[model samples]
Target: MSFWDDRYSRDEYVFGEAPNAFLAAQSHLLPKSGKALAIADGEGRNGVWLAEQGLDVLSLDASPVGLEKAKKLAAKRRVKLSTKLLDISDYDWPAERFDVVAGIFFQFAGPDLRDTIFAGMIETLKPGGLLILQGYGPRQLEYKTGGPGILENLYTEALLAEKFSALEIFHLGDRDGEVAEGSAHVGKSHLVDLVGRKAG
Candidate 1:
C-alpha cells in the first residue's frame, strides 16, 4: 500500500468528513452548476461537498484506499462523486475543462512538483473559471498542526502569486488562525488562501 493508502486505512477520516473551512467559505464564488475538480481529495470530503453544491465533481487522489472511502462517503451523502487515481507528477491535466479547481491542504509536493501541479490547476480551468487553494504557509512549520514538515512543501504568498499568475487573482492572503478540519488538522495554523479567475 502507498503512504496515503496506509494513512487512510484507519476507521476514521484522518482529515475529518467535513470540507475545508476555506473551501466552504468560498461557496458563493462557485457556479450554480458546473464541473469542479478536487485535487488530492482524501476520503472525498471536499469533493463530496462540491457535489452537494450542485457541481459535477471529480476527486483525484493517488491512493486507491482513499478513493474507495471517498466513494462510500459520496453514497452516504447521497451525492454523486467521480473519483480518479492519479499522481499529479504525471497527470495530463485536461485543458479548459472545469469551472472550478480546488486544492485545499495539498502541500505534500515539493518545489518542482508543486510547480507542475500548480500549472496544471491553472490549465484545467475553463474560461472565467475559479481557482481556489488553501495551504499551510511557511510558518506552519512552527505550528506543526498538519501538512508536510518540509519548509519547501509549505506555501508562501509570493510563491502562490508567482505560480498562479496566469489568473486574475482577486483574493490572496496569509494569516494564523484556528483550523478544525478533522483529527489531522485541528489547532492553530499558519495558512494561505488564494482565489483567482481565468480570463473569460
Candidate 2:
C-alpha cells in the first residue's frame, strides 16, 4: 500500500468530513447545473458537497481505501457521486469538459506532472467554465503544519496565474486561514486560493 493508502486505512478521515475552506468560500460561484470534477478527492468531502449542491460530480483518487470511504460518505450524505480509482497522472482527463472543476489541497510531484495536470484541468473545462483550486503556498513550509514536505509541491499565485494564463482570474490571493481537516491538517494554514473562468 502507498503512504496515502496507509494513512487512509485508519478509521477516521484524515481531512475531516467537512468541505474545504476555499471550496466553501467559493460555493456561490458554482452553477446549479452541469458536470463537476474533483481531483484527488481523498474522502469525498468536497465532491459530496458539490453533489449536494446539485451538480453531477465525479470524484477521483489514487487510494482505494480513501475511495471506499468516499463512497460511504456519499451514501451518508444521501448524494450520488461517481468515484474513480485512478492515478491522477495516468488517467485520461476527459476531453469533453465540465462546467466546473475543483482541486482542493491536491498536490503533485513536480513541474512535468504539474504542467500536465494543470493543462488537463483546463482541457476538461468547457469554454466559460470555472476552476476552483487551493493549495499550500511556499510559506506553508515555514509553518510546517501540514501538506507535502517537498517545497516543489507547494504553489504560488504567480505560478498559477502563469499556468492558467488562458483563463481570467476572478480571484487569487495568498493568506492564512483556520483549517481543520481531521488530524492531518489543522490550525492556521498558509495557502494560495484561485478562482478563474475560462475565456470564451
Instruction: Show model 2 residue runs off by greater than 4 Å.
Output: none
Best by lDDT: 1
lDDT of 2 by residue, 107-192 (tens): 75577898898999999998889999999988787777898878888889899999988889989989987788889998878889
Question: lDDT of candidate 2 vs native?
Answer: 0.89
Regions more than 4 Å wrong, model 1: none
lDDT of 1 at 170: 96
lDDT of 1 by residue, 1-200 (tens): 88899999998998999999999999899999999999999899999999999999999999999999999999999999999998878789999999999999888888889999999999999999999999998788888999898988888899989998899999999999999877899899999999999999
lDDT of 2 at 140: 81
Using all chains and alpha carbons, the TM-scores for the candidates as numbered come to 0.98, 0.97
Global CA lDDT computed for model 1:
0.93
